[model samples]
Target chain A: MFGIRSDLPLRRDTASRFVVWLVMVLVFMASLAVTVNSYIGVLIDDWNRSVTGTLTVQIPIAAAGDKASAILVNKVLDVLARHPAVAKSEAVPRAKITALLGPWLGNSEAISDLPLPALIDVEMATEGTEAVTAVTASIKAAAPEAVIDDHRVWLNRVMSLAQGFGVVALTIMLLVTGALALTIVFATRASLAEFAQVIDILHVVGAKDGYIAAQFARRALVQGIIGGAAGLALYAPALALVAWLASRVDSEVLPDTALPAAHWLTLAALPLAAGLLAMLTAHITVRRALSAKV
Target chain B: MALGRKKAEEISGDAVGLEAVGLHYDDGPDVLKDVSLSIPQRSFHFLTGPSGAGKTSLLSLMYLAKRPTRGNLKLFGENVTQAKRGRLAAIRRHLGVVFQDFRLLDHMSAFENAALPLRIAGVGEAVVQRNVNELLNWVGLEDCKGAYPAQLSGGQKQRVAIARAVVNRPKLILADEPTGNVDDTIAMRLMQLFVELHKLGASVIIATHNESLVARFPFPRLHLDRGSVSILPPLASSAEFDHDDPRG
Candidate 1:
């Protein structure tokens, strides 16, 4: 802790320091909220971007024609397997498909009797090169009914939308953090001006602006860190509850997904970043205010 | 050179000097003009004048509150006209000021106010504690050390201000009407403290309208009238019939 300028030793009271700490904590929390939301947005965008290049081959047939359809799917898979960019290919077994649709279709007799497609989920190693054009040409000539659902056509647009949304969210968070920093700076400047007489007294007694500003900046930094931590603590449970709620919903049209570890890690980094940002802004503002006075 | 030798003597001198020093508030008429004088090292002096005689204005210049419009101001033998902020701060540490209003930080206690000068100097805690307690006891405000400025009486506040000013043992002490808000007995006692400080090697410059008090102390006088200073011939002990009346 920095020494306050004055010959008169002020009575050390913990109450005032605590109040300052509480205020900083609240500011820190606000910063944390912006950080977590921005990070989550970033994670979703990354996931969306990663999943775009792959395609699935679905062959639907009447119940009587299922055995023949399986043979045709095998022929199409053979052609796809020979492609240079095809990293790995696997056919999603009918039993696994039935289990995936279980919650939506339930265990009803009607759903059990309904015929389903024989689907082959394919993945390509091409990071930059489009493997779909060559693979489609090979598969179509081998099996007439084989449909290569090249996900790129729609995934490109979807991933781009996700990235655009993340950018907008990030922009909003940056703006909010900037506004909070400005508010703290303005408040500190006002406090400094109001105590001009005290400043003059301190100045004549050899108190440097750095000394005084450090006291103010340290207080503001602590307040921001505490605020961010407290807010994050509160937000953690709320976010968990929301994630829990999201997990309880039955999967039908929407895919059943779990948030990645990277998303959680990003969320955790928010509060600390918020605290540092608040401290930096407060430090700069207080130093400027003191310098202006001198 | 003559100038270098003079500068050396000035730096080692116990007091400061003002040469043709004039002050003006941004675009306003001059508040002080053509004031040239040297306060002898370790000497005590009283400034006397009627209302609005620029006593406070003159003091402000000495304390470095407002820069002068024209003239050479020498503090501790250093020419302050082109002094950097760092140099000015170094000189300021050797100076103390007591304002008329007591100008104590409202947020701090009386003890804190006194400890302020020490704290600014970055004195160690144990040393600060010892010095602060001694000064508080000296001012007769040990019991009220924890009390805030608003809670203290006028005389007590003035004593605290004096204690704070002298805490650093500054080379010069500037007091603006140190006894204005107190009674005669308290005022006289306060005057005694200034005398005590002067005896201990700190040159004292007090601005006041209390002529009777000024007469009681046989010090050189600086009289300010119409924005200029006139050094009256130093007063001798009064031979007049003054033994009967303490107020006189």
Candidate 2:
């Protein structure tokens, strides 16, 4: 006789099922967006560290063949090595250069006929664009046919692309949160309307508004937790599939898709936060709706 | 402080009191006008009127569901008209109401519906079980305790409503058409239940148009007509009560 019984329907009706499914999908998308954004941020930082404070020098191949071009490349390397801003410099091997072009130019006997430029790789000790400028002048003076390429310009473009991706990810997360809130609001209002008589009976029986709101809030909290868990459960397999597909590609083409163990904790909190949001939203909604009634 | 406390003690003697209370819907005509009356502690009264005569409206005021548009209302000596929304729950908890339409929660069983008032009052589980079981047994609903509202007959639903109203042993009971849908035997049994409640020091106010039932019991009645109310003595025939005359 003292057992607690639910005044509202306990079944997985259409409206409630729809709300749970919608919340799950929205949370899944939000989690994916946030994870992707974090990965891109890490990639940008890694790329920036590798590309900054570095320069590449290219010497045009002379009609006299590899002997003349090699002389110009060594002269450019000697100039870079003597410069105060240059940390270290080395002449790139012809085999390494050929391998760099191997993806584009096939390893056929005819490939040897094409005249490729000799290259020098340089690492700078001093920071700033001015240091690069000074080293470029020194290399040009030493070898007139040589061209200096400071990677900062290309790095800036890549950083801009990463920033754009971050912005898009953030916007998608915000949209998902908004859609989740609206879906909850709609579902909460519909539940309140459907159970108006039950609510009125509670009211007449001396149950406070908080008591009535708590009933709804508790139901919403349970649904939210279930939906959130379902979304997160599907997320693991989806992430694994993505990592698998990414592993099949060349590492040079794609950034590392594997997330750190610590990042998983953050992703795990998403569903929990969604559940709390649903509970709080339902609490406020039910109270507001009850206050409007007689 | 002593004088104020004495005055409060004196006011606490009344179970329900209204001072020139008036009620209206929006800007429409008054449903109840300048009605002043007091039900002494443990008194029982039948509120009688034709359909649309505002019997339910007057009962609404008594149960704290609706505040009078103009004038003061005191439930168990508390100024409920001036009470805040949060304070209303505390005051309402001391009063029980049986609705005319039998507003039972369809999803809940008869036992759960009967145990609602005690649960709301935060009674302990053991006490709730004991009191609710005994009350259901008295109401002849012990066997149907597991049955939901949809599965119960109209008389059974009415009994569940009554059990809920009295479960908390409230200081006052306000019932609207408590026996309108039941058979004569069940109706007599329900009236006997109200009498038993009154004997336990709870003032009972039952609104009904059943003249035979009114005649069967020696309870005073407050007759309402054209937005006005007049008190009639116990055992007084309703036929002798004039509808047009304010002085009855």
Predicted structure with the largest DockQ when compared to the true one: 2
- Interface RMSD of the candidates, in order: 2.6, 1.5
* Local accuracy of candidate 2 as per-residue lDDT tens digits, A207-242: 888988877777777777778888888898998898
Candidate 2 C-alpha error for residue A226, in Å: 2.1
| Model 2 lDDT on a 0 to 1 scale | 0.82
lDDT of 1 by residue, B1-248 (tens): 12244556655753777889887888988889888888877888888888898999888788887677899888767777667666667777778899888888777889888888887787887888899899788667889999999999988998889888888888789999998888887777677677777878888999988877777767779999988898875454545314413344
Cα deviation at A230, candidate 2, in Å, is: 2.8
Give the whole-model CA lDDT for all candidates, comma-separated: 0.72, 0.82
Off by over 4 Å in 2: A1-5, A12-14, A59-76, A82-85, A102-116, A126-146, B1-13, B182-189, B216-218, B236-248
Best by the TM-score measure: 2
Pick out the ten consecutive residues of candidate 2 chain A with the lowest summed lDDT: A1-10
Off by over 4 Å in 1: A1-54, A58-75, A81-120, A123-133, A140-147, A250-275, B1-14, B82-87, B181-189, B237-248
State in Å the error of residue B231, model 2: 1.6
